[model samples]
Target chain A: MKTLVYVAHDNVHLGDATLATVTAASKLGEVHLLVAGAGCGAVAEAASRIAGIGKVHVADDAACEHQLAENIAPLIAGLMTDHDAVLFPATTTGKNIAPRVAALLDVMQISDILSVEGERTFTRPIYAGNAIATVESSDAKLVITVRGTAFDKAEAEGGAAEIAAVASTDDAGKSSFVSAELAKSERPELTSAKIIVSGGRALKDSATFENIVMPLADKLGAGVGASRAAVDAGYVPNDYQVGQTGKIVAPEVYIAIGISGAIQHLAGMKDSKTIIAINKDEDAPIFQVADIGLVADLYQAVPELTAAL
Target chain B: MKALVPVKRVIDYNVKPRVKADGSGVDLANVKMSMNPFDEIAVEEAVRLKEAGQIDEIVVVSIGPAKAQETLRAALAMGADSALLIETEEAIEPLAVAKMLKAVSGEVEPGLIILGKQAIDDDSNQTGQMLAGLMNLPQGTFASKVELEGDHVRVTREVDGGLETVRLSTPAIITTDLRLNEPRYASLPNIMKAKKKPLEIKTPADYGVDIAPRLKTLNVSEPPVRQAGVKVADVDELIARLKAMGVA
Candidate 1:
């Protein structure tokens, strides 16, 4: 199978999710990458170095600067002539664009596959990861979004592949870029972090959450995360939320502070290698999945833990 | 300008689904169903837009079995002017659903369309973007906040990183995220009034769309359960355990 993986990037640096996606694509067969953005030659160059990629196709044009679905879908669909399957990283951008391509190609999309069972068969979580469904596609062409944490990241530096330029398609003139407010943080991104320290509504407000969570996260070189209750209570930004509706992370260690593990929250982080929970309530659901449970008030324990670390 | 909101009746968010012993799919024989949480937000946003004078009419639609009319009536009670139900018993994929909605859009000619990002049942976040692709319309997906300008709409999107604002011309598509708005409950009087609202029932055949499943579910099963581990007496023991596991 010839699979085309959409390279997630910011026109300069390739996204970490793309490397994992390439690994997922490599499992099927030959993997080719599509780098669609304005002046993204560096991204194409980075994609070519990923271990098993066969080719890097660059669509350098102004229309794709924002990676808008209106401009990127047609470009990917047109490139589907030679590829049997098109894979995306299942990031926000991938989720936004892949559906348009699937619709344009008139195929059903298998989203956030956990494993590739057969050439056309895969398993995906439904009902917020409560049930797993194995599905097979009979379509002539396949469109899929891969969950990044389910696969290991491909080696960043290794083989050299040929980079070729593809003709850019015209803009659909439907949507236009206005502005973006991305959080600027020095901490490792939550999805790729080695360790994550997440807080819940028990922190009370934003100031207390930042004071309590950030100190421990900073000391441990961990990414800061929050439960949906924290985000809904205005204790943290939405991007900091780690749950079924938020970012899914399976890091080396995940420490839940005062989070009464809702099923949705557990869905995102239960796959972590080491799970630790620190909550006052001994009967919190978080203890069910926690590898190490510490029944304590977070106010006293978190500060002590940070000092010890 | 008229607004269209598409809602889906799915296993309620509060209900835990159980896989069938026969491996057919999640058991829904006697499961409680409600409007998909995000679609309820979509309906709420449309009602707010109508109340704000930015929208002249609100038309809600659902593509499901006959019972979906209850979901449509719920939307009607929430301030939608009318409703449409594309009745079908067979399971329809997102691509087919988008195609049917495309035909509905042709007849409705809505200036704005709002839909849930994904249904909790299938969890396939595709229909809105697919419908936008099929109709060649602008799309602002995962919108947290939406405001109308003179001829364009400004939408604040909830992305993986943070918030992004985009401006799109009229006759566009917007999919609601979790933070869009808190949905309103249908009051007693409004529920009674909704019984008299217009609701038209159609089929995929009526719109020349094929409601076929392209993907086949080979089996359905439960995910592996995570085992609970040891409890630590204090932070020191937790640190020691983490260190022993080489994760601290």
Candidate 2:
């Protein structure tokens, strides 16, 4: 099988660049890495070192700068004819782009791939993430969205192949590039954060919100987060949101404060390693998923917890 | 302007989902079903737009079993002019749902299509974007505020970054994030009015949509159990532990 991996410098590059190599070595295939833009020469170089990659394909164009879906989707569909299977790192960009590419191919698209059980199989979450489901798509030309964080990145090894120019569109130019604001934080991103601190609507007012959420995050050196209600209430920014409508976070320790643990919010943080919930309501939905539950006011508990840590 | 909203029957948000002993899936035999929470928000947003005179009408749709009409009523009660159910027992993927709606969008020629970011049960947040892709329209996902500007729509949304505002041409797709709006309870009068409202039932085959399972599910399993950790005796102990772990 020839596996073509579509990678972006911002979202797809990881410590080991494993998505480029994992199925590459595991399954006998020709691996082609599509470094979507420039400055990811490092990522392409990393892909070449992986044992299974047959060639490194760089779709370099000034329009490829941001990998806007319109330009990349058609290009990937065009690339679909060359490969038996296509994989993309299951980032936000991956979630949107892979399926469209598959739809164009009239094939199956598997999302949030945990592991490849076989050449045409994977495990993913379902039902607001209360359970993990193993899935298989036997379609000839398969498109898969791989959770990049799940696989071990391969160490850099070999020579990088020459760059190739694939036809890309100015569709990104057609669509308005509205203002973009990245959530600036020294802490790791919620999706990839090892430790996460989440506050529920119990924070009461926006004035108490940062005090309730930020201190706990600071104490634990964790990324700060909020339940959908808290985010919706404008107590916290959307980037800090952890839930079904927001981010799916799988971290080592996820400390949820004042959160009611709605099913939607649980779906996002349920995959955490160490789950702790601090809420005034003992019966809050979050308690069901937490390893530790403290039925107390988050206001009193959070400050003391922060000071203690 | 016109609006399109999608509602799905899901296990009530408050119910605790049980993993079946066979691990086939969660049992929904006797579970109370309700309109998916986010879809209710979509309906609420559309209804609000109508009340504000921004949108002239709303057409709500659902793609599920026959019982889905019950879910559709919840939308009608919220002030949708009419409802459509593309009945199917087969669990439909988001992409196929999008394709069906793309056809519906052409028929109705709605100015905007509103949807829940994902149905809580299936939890696939793909349909809105796929519909936009299939229809070749601009999409403003997880919208917080959807405003009308003459012939175009200005959608304010919470992106992976901070809030972003996008201006798109007519026929845009806007998905509801939780914070979009608080759904209003259907009043007793409105509930009575909903029964008299029209509901058009169609089949997936009628829509020329083959609702096939693109990704086949093999098994369902519990995530690895997390071991309990002791509470630190003091701040100093917590600091020491952090230092030992190099997290400090």
Instruction: Indicate which candidate wins on TM-score.
Output: 1
- Which parts of model 1 have CA positions greater than 4 angstroms off? none
The sequence of per-residue lDDT tens digits that candidate 2 reaches over residues B111-227 is: 889998778786666777677777777777778788887878887776665666667777778888777788999999999999999999999888787777777777887755444
Residue-pair clashes per candidate: 0, 5
Provide the DockQ value for model 1.
0.87
Model-by-model DockQ, in order: 0.87, 0.40
**How far out, in Å, is residue B170 in model 2?**
2.1
Q: Encode model 2's per-residue lDDT on A216-271: one tens digit a residue.
A: 78777788888988877889777888876677777888888888878778777776
Worst 10 residues of 2 chain A by lDDT: A16-25
Candidate 1's residue-wise lDDT over B1-248, tens digit each?
A: 99999999999999999999988999998899999999999999999999999999999999999999999999999999999999998888999999999989899999999999999999999999999889888899999999999889999999999999988988999999999999998999999999999999998899999777899999999999999998899989887887787765
Screening candidate 1 with a backbone cut-off below 3 angstroms (N, C-alpha, C), the clashing residue pairs are none
Question: Any runs in candidate 2 off by more than 4 Å, and if so which?
Answer: A9-30, A37-56, A60-66, A153-161, A172-174, A212-221, A252-263, A273-309, B231-248
Shift of residue A62 alpha carbon in model 1, Å: 0.8
lDDT of 1: 0.94
Q: What is the C-alpha lDDT profile of model 1 across A70-178, one tens digit per residue?
A: 9999999999999999999999999999999999999999999999999999999999999999999999999999999999999999979999999889987878999
CA lDDT of each prediction against the hidden true structure: 0.94, 0.74
